[model samples]
Target chain A: MRWKHSDYTGWGRVHRASGELARPERAAALSELTKDETAPAIGMRRSYGDACLNDNGRAIDMSRLDRVLEFDPDSGVIHVEAGAQIGHLLKTFAPKSWLPPVLPGTGFATVGGCIAMDVHGKNHHGAGSFGQHVTEITLVTPKGEQIVTPKKHPELFKATIGGLGQTGPILSARFPLLKAKGDVMVVTERRVADWESFIGLLDTSEATYSVGWIDATARGAALGRGILEEAETGGGLVKPAKRGKKIPLNAPGFALAPPVVRAFNATYWRRVPDRGRTSVKPIDDFFFPLDKIHDWNKLYGKNGFHQFQCVVPLSSVDALRAILEKIANSGLASPLAVLKRMGPGRGGYMSFPMEGYTLAVDFPNKARAEQVIRELENMTVAADGRVYLAKDALASAANIRAMYPEHDKWLSAVTKADPDRAYETDLTRRLKLRDPA
Target chain B: MTPTWIILGATSTIARAFARLVAERGENLLLAGRDMAELNRTAADCINHGAPSAEAIAFDARDMASFAPILDKATATEGAINVAVFVGSMPTQDEIDGDPALIAGTITDSFTGPAQFLTLLAPLMEDRGKGAVVGVGSVAGDRGRLGNYVYGASKAGFHTYLSGLRNRLGRSGVHVVTVKPGTVDTAMTWGMDGLPFLAQPDKIASDIMRAVDKKKNVIYTPFIWWPVMTVIKSIPEAIFKKLKI
Candidate 1:
């Protein structure tokens, strides 16, 4: 395999990596490359932070290795190469009434990336994180190909899931697809008046899939005001999703200025009526709304952006509100913000979900925004919450360690799996995750 | 009756993509390749994608002995038995220069092997009176460049052979499409630098299917290669040899 020198970035585009990348298209080629020299495996680079970046080193690009190796219709189990995209899986199986149990905000994320990040979805409160659904994982370690499952090698399995690809390059995975009513989603959108009501609505929601779109720019009586979307899969026919449009160039910086954002948010909030509205949408439309606009990250312009995401306990709702208040006062928050409830279902030690409320807001890559995110990270730690590593680009290692109490266990497991640290990436180094210190 | 596409070198990136395309249309597939494991996986994938029936058969391009069984299996299904040949090899010119013995294998893989298999299958296509044959040749066949003249010469010979095959097959109502694709972003060109206007394997596959539907005999994929190759082919041999691309 020839290694091509490439300059790549995370979804945020705030962090960049110049590295040599080898994209192997077959399973034998992947094993052969890993046997000779191990490197971090990256798929799609959908992480908003540097979790996928390996600067000044060789990395394996697994995109072309994507394929469905096997599928058992009776059991709904699928064996796929790690590079298979979650969206592609849904497209293939959804029509047949089988769907991936957990889908992140974007369908572009590969199965390997979902496993590495332990991503959650709109149905996270019910289906849990992506790793929780996986039955088996084939990893290429220093010794050779090792198969790890929840039953066979539980510790290594937990460490590999949401393990940030530190344990080894994942070769393939086996997971069961959830039976769906159909390929379409019946969605209900209701406007939340304020913070208290929004929290109450989320707490009482019985929908299979629920998420809140918060207008971070709102203040006072309108604080936390947004649209609450609840959805459930149903048997129906809908038009095929339109062809995705690409963002050809970086948008001007002024395009998302505070005044412009406030105006946009106001328009968006008013788009949903007070009485609420019900619509039938393509599964991808409801699951990955912004994906229709390809490279939507470029909307933040050349400087890129950072997404500050953290989940606080059920009791820490007040603390979460205070953090939101601080963000609103700072006037640096973008219109793109989400609030969701998570269940106490997580597969890995480093997994990000808990039984609590999670808030995620995007901020332009400004010095002031960095300072605000640092303050938010501290507040999250104080509230016994943890920042999501997938979306975090500015959190300090000390703060991250404080958030994930199982850090030592994860570190020990990773060390045992990769003693030579050949799989380290920019995120691992930045967080000092491999260091006992 | 549903058509059955016998894809030679089915493990190849382009052939795999073409298999999926035809499979989605509910066609039957005979994925013929040397790698049984990989070909079986692709066969299963094609089935999942919507093929009525898909099977993997062993095929070694250089071994003419492995060719007849694939034809016999396709003939068992009473319908239009189409074929798409994606078998070829290109050892870098530097490697070829170091080991001159590689030329024979290159010629067998890129030209003589598939040509012989198709020669054996042509009469069967004539008996059926309806089928499509897609021959994947590279633009390198248009003019031998300094970088890979030997590999180019093999494809050039295959292209000429295909032209004659088309003439004979046209009389029996069978269509032939000679596809000249530019650099495609497959395993073959994955990390190759300075590849111009590289197309995706899926795009080339779709283009080939469209050409079959339209019965276009010779076409350049991505269309841009047509004008580009035109310029190169028109250049006098003296200047072309002197100017390195």
Candidate 2:
């Protein structure tokens, strides 16, 4: 395997890593590479923070190893390389009435990434986290490869899922696909007047998939105002999604200035009528709306951006509202803010899901924006909520440890799996997750 | 009737991309490669993509004995039988210079092996009288450069062989496409830097499919390589020998 020196960053682009990357095209090559020296495995690098970054270290790029190894139509079980993209799987299987049980905000997030983060989707209220549906995982450590299942190696399986890839490189996985009506989605979009109604709508939602687009710049009476989208799979004929357009150059810093973001959010909120409207859309359009604008992160300009995401318990709705109000008052939030309801279902000790409301907001990498995110992180910890490691870039190590009560359990399992810390990444090191301090 | 595509070196990036394209068009696929595990995964991927049927067959470009079973499997199926050759090996010029004996293996892998296999399959394809054979060569074959002359010479030989095969196969209504691709983003060129006009495997696969549909005898992928190679070929040999590319 040839190791290429490369400089890469996460999806947010705020944190960067200059490292040596080895991309093996076959499973045998991947096994051979990991047989002696193990490195952190990265797929598509879709995480918003440093989860996929390994500064001055070696990382194995698993993108080339993506391929469906086997599929049983009768049981809907699929054995696939860890690098397979969630969107590609949905596109290939939706036509046959099958879909991945959980899809993150972007289709580009690989199955391995989803498992590593235990990501949830709009259907989290029903389908649970991504790792919940995994039947088995093949993990490659420095020693060799081992097949891990929930029943055979329950603790190892839990540690591998949402374990921040500290255990080892996930080689492949077996998971059952969800049955879908068709490739298209019937979506209903409605406007929420304020924070109260938005939370009410989310709580009362009965749809299989539901999510809210929050207007973070709104204040006073319009605080937390946004659009609520509920969708279900339906058989229909629709035009194929257009090829994504690329953002050729970085925008000027003024592109996402507060005034501009407020204006854009106002217009976006107004796009949905007050009474709401229903439409038919390609599944991708509804799930990954931002993906249509390729490299949309460039809009944040050269310095890059950060996404602050956290989930709070149902009883902490007041704390969540206080956090939203703080964000609106700061006027530093980008237009890319989201609100969703999550279930208690989770597959790992480190998995970041609970029965609550989750909020995510993007901010350009500025001193003021970072300050606001820090404040938000403190508020989340005080509310007994956990900030998503996948999107966090500035949370304190102590705060992170305090949020996940079972951190010690995960650390012990990870230590047993990778005693030498061969799979340690920038995030794990920065957070001191394995230090046991 | 749906055609059955016999893809040699199916584990290769370009061949896998081509298999996916044809599979999506509802063709049957016989993925031939040395690594049965990798080839089986690719076959399953093709089936998932929409192929009516897909199977992996063991094949080694350097082993003549491994070629017959693939042809037999292809002939067993009715209707048109297509074959796409994407088998070739290139060790760095420095490695080849260290061990001159490497030249023989390179020649067999890139040129003579596929040539002999095609020579054996030609009669069967002519009898069927309906098929296309895609032989992927390289732009390096146009002119020997300071960097990789041995690999270039092998591809040059393959280009000449395909040209003659095209002449013989066209008479029986079987089209032959000689593909000369420039640098591609595959495992072979993963770490190499400063590669000009680097094309993706999907784009090359699509170009190959278009050439087959149009029955083009010789073509350069990404189109720009044709002009680029033309200028390089026009350069006098003395100047070329002194300069490094």
Quick one: best TM-score, which candidate?
2
Error of 1 at B54 (Å): 2.3
Q: Residues A1-437, candidate 2: write the lDDT tens digits.
A: 88999999998898999989999988899999997668999999999999999999999999877788888999899999999999999888888889899989999999899999999999999999999999999998766789999999989999999999988888899999988999999999999999999999999999999999999999999999999999999998999789689998999989998889989999999999888999999988988898899999999898999999999999999999999999999988999889999999999989999899999999899998898999999999999999999998899999999999889889889899988898999999999998976
Residue lDDT tens for model 2, B1-245: 88999998899999998999998899999999899988888998899889999999998888999998988898899989899999999999999999999999999989999999999999999999999999999998999998999999999999999999989999999999999999999989988999999999889999999999988989999999999999999999978888888
Model 2 residue B68 lDDT score: 86
lDDT of each: 0.93, 0.93
Worst 10 residues of 2 chain A by lDDT: A138-147
Considering just chain B, what TM-score does every model have?
A: 0.99, 0.98
Where does candidate 1 chain A have its weakest 10-residue lDDT segment? Answer: A64-73
Model 1 residue A301 distance off true place after TM-score fit, in angstroms = 2.0
Q: What stretches of model 2 exceed 4 Å from their correct place?
A: none
Q: Write down the DockQ of candidate 1.
A: 0.65
